[model samples]
Target chain A: MTKSKLSQQLAVDNLKIGSHVYSSRLIVGTGKYPSEDIASKAINSSGAELVTLAIKRFSQQDAISNILEVIGEKKLLPNTAGTLNAKEALRSAQLSRELFKTNLIKLEIITSSENLDPNMPETIKAAEMMVKDNFEVYVYCDRDLNNCLKLEDLGCVAIMPLGSSIGSGRGFDDLDDLILLRNKIEQILIVDAGIGVPSEAARVMELGYDAVLVNSAIAYANEPILMASAFKNGVKSGRKTFLAGRMSRSKSSIASSPTQFLK
Target chain B: MSRIKIQLNGTVEQIESANLEIILNTFAPKDRPFAVEINGEIVPSAKFSDYSIQENDKIEIISAVGGG
Candidate 1:
């Protein structure tokens, strides 16, 4: 192959988030699957380098879950799923550090359960604390450009803007706002939450997003294995398209065949 | 011994116990991986036997569940 083609392939092969570099850009979450076996199959098939799990009380009554053992070699990202404020989120983070033994924390602080939108004030406060602790934090936030910029300045590794509310299955129609945020931020951008299908994930990647974190959509699907494969392909196809660039569209007739002779 | 009330993972329990280890023995199964926090301070495993539990001291035994 040509030198340019080989070099371009190598460049897209590695996705860097903070100090963590991964070959696969898609990050899967270990939630909402019918069972652990199904979750394991889905995760393994998804080809995701990093997987997210909510850190909760470790009770003996609860079935023991060795997710680290299940998804072998994949980075275990512990998130503050149920935290409503900064203090709670920080406590969860500190505790998770002891358990997971990783500095990476996905800061998820939500106030309203109805829409499950992230609390900006709480998220910002928690991000500051995580930074001070030298934790490589990924901020789960809204698509607001200003909030993303603020997080980027505070040494966050990646800025994860929700496609919509968490677990809504609602697709992001406000592509303009997302575009604005994407253009404004220099940090690695990941569209987390509200992805209903593989197409949604593909659309986000086609818009130049670095990665996506999918859970409910795939996990809750009737056929998670097939869905996972679709997502893996979707992410790869979208990334390739983004690198390949697109042809301009026109309202008037633009013939693809024998246009030179006709014109 | 006069018992003290502490919230363990958000559950209120009246225990005759005086230390974190006694509390763990009361609630958690003997063989399990876990962590403890007393009023938001995570007490290391070694300190569980020595750290005395006082009245109304929010001692939380965080139990991890499988979730994403």
Candidate 2:
């Protein structure tokens, strides 16, 4: 009989944002699924405690089942995905709070339609208003360190930097800045968007990111449920590796075998 | 029955009554969770029954959809 050292070494680690605590560091989005059944199954397999949903117009004559019915008891983090400016984002946030009855919001104010880049000024404006309105805002910004620092100063509960352009799946576009940003920011940092595989999730976690929000990689996969499970394991492994404290990188390779062995 | 015209979700619609709750119930199930706004102000669910809908009011009924 053997005991796993990794399990023994790690304590109970939970991701906390504002007053809410989540057990899973992987946050899943409920978008671009083939069906609600598949989305539900995939989300279940991922073991995500927090899920992101976007608020949109409710059609009058639509007979389709509501997405909320499948979400059940999982905590909802509503995002203002389509808003272009501060006013629209604020209204969307208010409506989301009223509908979901939660103050947790993912503030996204996209500036360009072609690239879908976030409007930094508009996002900051919306974030400040949301915070003043007593909402726990989680901002989605670019990798620019100065903008991220400004966002943190505005009282957001979490800062989500795009892994690449949204849904581009190019992995991390700027790894160096990501590492530096990790050292600077003290709030909960979750790398959101543009992550295509489990290994990338692992890589982000290995860099000591608190969490990762993935949607397209899992939702659009050939087998979403299986992919979801893979990401869950990836996140866990990365977190454990981070906790273990990785060996320092050396310019020259040191031989593993002892040089003076059996002399 | 007299009808009043108001904008519902960006479209002009004629309704039989001016009650907010009745209009909401007619379009959506009571069990479904959603939020209603009239001319840019959010109306709480509890107030739906007590609130009155005005003519030409731009009403937007919103709910959660899949997103990341």
Candidate number of the best lDDT: 2
Docking band of candidate 2: high
Docking class of 1: acceptable
Write the residue-wise lDDT of candidate 1 on B1-68 in tens digits: 78788777777888897877877887764443566778889888888789898878887666444455
lDDT of candidate 1 over A77-128, digit per residue (tens): 8899888999989999888887667899999998765657899988998999
What DockQ does each prediction reach against the true complex?
A: 0.48, 0.83
TM-score of each model, in listed order? 0.89, 0.94
Calculate the i-RMS of every candidate, to one decimal place: 2.4, 1.2
Backbone N/Cα/C clashes per model:
6, 0
Candidate 2 Cα outliers beyond 4 Å, as residue runs: A1-9, A60-62, A259-262
Evaluated at residue B2, the lDDT of candidate 1 is: 84
